[model samples]
Target chain A: MEKIISLHNQHVKDWKKLLTRKQRKKTGTYLLDGWHLINEALTANVNVKSLIITSDQLEEHDDIVTRDFPIYEVTDEIMRAITDTVTPQGIAAEVELPTDQFDIPESSRGAWLFLDQVQDPGNIGTMVRTADAAGFTGVVAGSKTADLYSPKVVRSMQGSQFHLTLRHGNLDEWIELFKKQHFPIYGTQLNPEAKNFRDVAPAGSFALVMGNEGNGLSDNILSQTTSNLYIPMNGRAESLNVAVSAGILMFQLNQNIK
Target chain B: MEKIISLHNQHVKDWKKLLTRKQRKKTGTYLLDGWHLINEALTANVNVKSLIITSDQLEEHDDIVTRDFPIYEVTDEIMRAITDTVTPQGIAAEVELPTDQFDIPESSRGAWLFLDQVQDPGNIGTMVRTADAAGFTGVVAGSKTADLYSPKVVRSMQGSQFHLTLRHGNLDEWIELFKKQHFPIYGTQLNPEAKNFRDVAPAGSFALVMGNEGNGLSDNILSQTTSNLYIPMNGRAESLNVAVSAGILMFQLNQNIK
Candidate 1:
């Protein structure tokens, strides 16, 4: 195993860049922290470029070490320098970003979730995780949505990104595509004219659009939907958290659709 | 308006204690940050013990200033000391904790949510927020759940705590109470014998139990449930985030109940 103790090591500097979205996008790779995430990445057959582990963690994660990948042993201080978290998990991996362009399959009848400018990293991650659990076909992240590879988002996603299709797309273009394919697109909003979600029945194929945290679906997006649905609020809260709303709608719409 | 520039001021020292759960429990009060939450307290008629704001924030929140309460103008440094956030929102308030014990009314038919040892403050807070949005009557937080007043939790809850019934209770006792009242208590789990959530019909009165992040409901608690329901996973993700699961269940069960 390669050993490095110096915080100023050239390799450390490059690994540190994975912490930022710009660098991650430029390098086409990002860091995954903790054993659970790394294991999930391996299970999902993601392209894991290298493993970085502290001296003590090396023995604890011998199974991962057995893999034919370059393993670097770093001091605890060096691990901290490379991680964004306060307490570094003592192990991380450089994993290549998924680059496949998501295309709607010709016979696609599965549900899909489209996020519109959802800014919060945790919210974006939870939405992706929920989409995976609901067994949706994929997620189309709007341009303004939080970066899917950011550490905070990756952590919240809990490795769901690997289990399902996640790709960036212009929501307008995708909505047009779904329309051409005869798939119903549902936009979630609280408009007075919007039908309550319970009133809608699950269809074999559908696209659900969830909006930004502060605003519901954008006006242009709302104008394009086949119908708008609202999760009727019986209590005093003005609205549900965007991710929570997505979970409810995704599961409800996807239930038995397969 | 009282001006407090010195960080060592006695009143400032006392207010700082609200940052800790033990101190909050002892004082029967907790600190609420930002203009939004303080305003929510005022609008909800929650007892505002005092208002702490920096000089610049006073005019920005003039509406809150007009309320009859002891307003303190503190230095920016002092304001930071009393707040748990890095960027002190320039304003905060000491609000009395709701002391009312939640009890199921004899004729009550409204839905309720019981959280079992949900440890993450964000998850606990999100559950409470979802329960409120779903129009559930209240939330019974299990003894091992995160402190509702913790800064992380309060932030995630987004002032929904002030809009709903939130009280910690022993799950065993509450489950008994729910049973005697004839409220169907649904425990969420992945048991093969568990019914799929889609098969369950919404009833006017029900109680949904969400469990710990790492472990589902404890064996003892699971045994007492009227029925266990699982949100079927359509993909490879092991499970949904506890908060997302709670959100899906709460909205589905609450729909048409009212």
Candidate 2:
């Protein structure tokens, strides 16, 4: 056990830096702010680098204190300075970012959600959580999508990140991989001319592409899909929230649920 | 045109209070930040109490400036102080909150989303937007749910608030009204014992009730519904986000969308 009380301590400074995307990229590590997330990471056997806790929390988290990982005790103020949440949970963990390249099976079956520049961290996290609930095989977050390990995404994800394969890859490359496997690639559009989602029966092996919050799937991606689908909106709302749309489509297309 | 540049101006002090639920309830008016929401309110003929704008934006929005509404010009800093966003959109509106007590028809023949204590402003707003897209007749947010007119809810709702009837009423009263009309009331639960949502035929008229974030429907409400329903989840995620679940259930139960 190590005690670091100063706000300017090197460990505190490094943990604070993990809040930014650039720092996380440089160090290949991210911070989990509360017990719930840290507990999930430990359960999933994630490579947790260290446990950081306020002096008062050290005794309560004694279960983890005796574990193999290094533990650092800091003041409450230092804990608050390091975590992004308004109310710091007094316990945090630094986990190694997973670098495993998720593989698409030769005969890819089950739903896979591909985010095409979906930038909202909350939306991206919710969609991923929804994908996990829908029993999707994995989620491929395309370039320009919000960083999956960002603080906001991690908080909204609520530990579902541990349940499924998550990867950051080029949308085009992922689309091509699914095509190679002969899995139907489904892209969404607002146009009525696009095939209605209900009309497309759920399939075992398929990819459902959701686009950015404002602009939907890029024209290039749309042009590459097996078919573009639309959810018919009988009301006046211009469009559905990207995450909500993804949830609806993923559940609808995972035909094996029924 | 009234020009108000001082932060301490009486109107400025009063307008800033509209950000809170108490002030909005006291005045029966809420602030709509940005032109998109203002435009929607105008199009829907919602009683736009007044228009607040930055001096530079007045010329750009001449169409609105010349309209039959009181126009007040304020400094950029004043606009920022009066708005909740980090970056104010330079224009906003003070709208009279709709007080119409939406009467249920003898034959309540459309989807109505009843939210029970769904606390997140963003989730509440997103659900309203989804209900609007699903062509629901109205959204009745019961007690303990986030205030519909709170700045966060108003912002996340975009302009969909103008597209549907929104009410704050007693859930029991609403359920009784629907029951009187013989409309099925569908309550949601995560338990598998509940009827699978897919098996329930979409009806011409029904009430879809969504519950709080941490808890599903309260036992009292669940026991009162025509039948409780559950969305089958094949994956290991604990549960879906409240808004996403509402979107999936609303679309699946709408039945009218072919």
Model 2 off-target regions past 4 Å? A101-109, B101-108
Best by lDDT: 2
Model 1 clash pairs? none
TM-score of 1: 0.93
TM-scores of all candidate predictions against the true structure = 0.93, 0.96
Candidate 1 docking classification: high
TM-score of the second chain in candidate 1? 0.94
Per-residue alpha-carbon lDDT of candidate 1 for residues B1-258, written as tens digits (9 for 90 to 100): 888999899989999888788998898888899978987988889898898989888877677667788999998899888886778889989999887643434444568888888899988888888888888888888888778888888988889988877877787888887788887889999765798877786666788999999898988889999999988888877888898899888876775685
Per-residue lDDT tens digits for candidate 2, residues B188-245, read 9999999998888764678999999999888889989998889888988999999999
For residue A67, what is the lDDT in candidate 2? 89
Superposed model 1: Cα runs more than 4 Å off: A63-65, A101-109, B61-66, B101-109, B202-204, B256-258
State residue A121's C-alpha deviation in candidate 1, in Å. Answer: 1.0
